[model samples]
Target chain A: LAKTTQPISMDSYEGQEVNITCSHNNIATNDYITWYQQFPSQGPRFIIQGYKTKVTNEVASLFIPADRKSSTLSLPRVSLSDTAVYYCLVGWRGGGNKLTFGTGTQLKVEL
Target chain B: EAGVAQSPRYKIIEKRQSVAFWCNPISGHATLYWYQQILGQGPKLLIQFQNNGVVDDSQLPKDRFSAERLKGVDSTLKIQPAKLEDSAVYLCASVPGQNTEAFFGQGTRLTVV
Candidate 1:
């Protein structure tokens, strides 16, 4: 099974860029790194997914180094609504792969 | 596009009673998942099903919890003689295909007293 570890919580101010890092030292060769964000009283929403290097989208950017042992999710110009729990997951591509979630990083963006 | 659908939105049952939750995955999705999210914790995978066949249930407490997917489209999770510890949010998710991101439903909040 693939396991991920990240900061239990984080704090930031509105308009500040927030970066949440996760470590998956034992990730397999075929695994992909994915991130999800969950707000209070709602299910998690997929933030981004990447295989390697830097993948940038409108909401965030994912940076995966050559080692692939760790990845970073960067949220630019965040607002109070960006406060949520973010999860990092490592899993294979096909064949009924499962995800084992960690405690996740609780990002609190204040005004 | 529809993400995922689950009901009832909230359910409260006394300990030793039974409760069931349902999930309808996005159209054409081939994989479904059931998760248990306790307060202040990440969602925990309880079971995984691919096209009506269970792929994993190692974390599920088989002594009390059970789940099934019909025709690989819809699923139901049941707790018999529910325990207070079972109070939490039951979440459902679906993946379109290999190497894709998952879409989650609003979830059913289960309270056992």
Candidate 2:
């Protein structure tokens, strides 16, 4: 498993876009960058996943640089309801089949 | 259409007591996982099962914790002689396969005194 480092917390206002970046200096070639959003008292929800370049979904976008050493999760038009903890996971597609979640970045969306 | 299910949302027990938690994965999901999350920390994988076979349990305290997934469907995690450090939320998750996303239950919160 590749260890990831991300901000502890970030603050954003309504209608603004929020971007959270994660650094994985020792990422493996077979590893994928995945992001999950977790609300209070709820399970973490899959936001987006990418192996490289960019991938977008109905909820968010993932941007991975050419080196694949880091990735960013971009959320469009933030709202108060978007306040949650964001997790960046770097793991191989298969193998252990375990998710190693770190102390996620807490995003606070204010009005 | 239903998601993963867990029973006994909360449990309070004294040290040296025994407690068990149950989990039912989503229909047709072959992979199940159990994780422990302490306050202000991310979930740590305790065990992983592919169908009825164990995949990984290196992090589990085998001396006191045991888990079984019989018939490759419902699973149970039991802890005997629980300690105060065992207080945390236990989350159960299931994924269809290595290529699919995982879904987690609300989790069982355990408090040991």
Candidate 3:
């Protein structure tokens, strides 16, 4: 499993865009980047995933550079409800691959 | 469809006591995982099971912890001689197959006094 490092905390206001970057210096060729959002007292929810370049969904966008050493999760039009911890996971897709989580980036969206 | 289900949302026990938590994954899900999440830290994978067979349990404390999925539908995790450090949330998650997003259940919070 590739270890991930991300900001411990970030601050944002309503209607602003939030970008959380995660660095995995030892990412493997077969690994994919996946993001999850976790609120207090609830299980983490899948946000988006990508192998390289950019992938967007109804919830968020995942951008992986050509090097694949790092990726960014972009959230548009943030609101107070978006306040939660975001986790970046790098792992293989199939064959019962294990997914490990880091400390995660805590996004605090305010009014 | 219903998500993963866990029982006893919270538990409190003394050191050296034993406790068990139950989990029922979504119907027909092939993979189930158990994780321990400490306060202010990310969830750590304790074990993974595929159709009632163990796949990974290197991170689990074998001497003190044990988990089983007898019928590949429901599972249980037990901890004996619990220590103060055992206070954490136990999470259960399941995926439909090898290639799919996992669905997690609201974890059981355990506090060892």
> Which residue pairs in candidate 1 collide?
none
Predicted candidate 2 versus true structure: per-residue lDDT over B1-108, tens digit per residue: 999999889999999999999999998898899999887788889999999999999999999999999999999999998999999999999988655477889899
Q: What docking grade does candidate 3 earn?
A: medium
> Which stretch of 10 consecutive residues in model 2 chain A shows the poorest summed lDDT?
A91-100
Give per-residue CA lDDT, model 2, range A11-48, as digits (tens): 99999999999999999998888898888767777788
Residue A15 accuracy (lDDT) in model 2: 100
Off by over 4 Å in 1: none
Off by over 4 Å in 2: none
Better model by DockQ, 1 or 3? 1
Candidate 1 vs candidate 2, TM-score winner = 1
- Tell me the native contact fraction for each prediction: 0.65, 0.48, 0.56
lDDT of 3 at A39: 93
| Clashing residue pairs for model 2 | none
DockQ: which candidate is best?
A: 1
Clashes in model 3: which pairs?
A: none
Q: What is the lDDT of residue B4 in candidate 2?
A: 91
TM-scores of the candidates are: 0.97, 0.97, 0.98
Where's the lowest-lDDT run of ten residues in candidate 2 chain B? B95-104
For A1-111, candidate 1 gives per-residue lDDT tens digits of: 678999999999999999999999998899999999999999999999899999999999999999999999999999999999999999886746686678999999999
Best by TM-score: 3
Candidate 3 TM-score versus the reference: 0.98
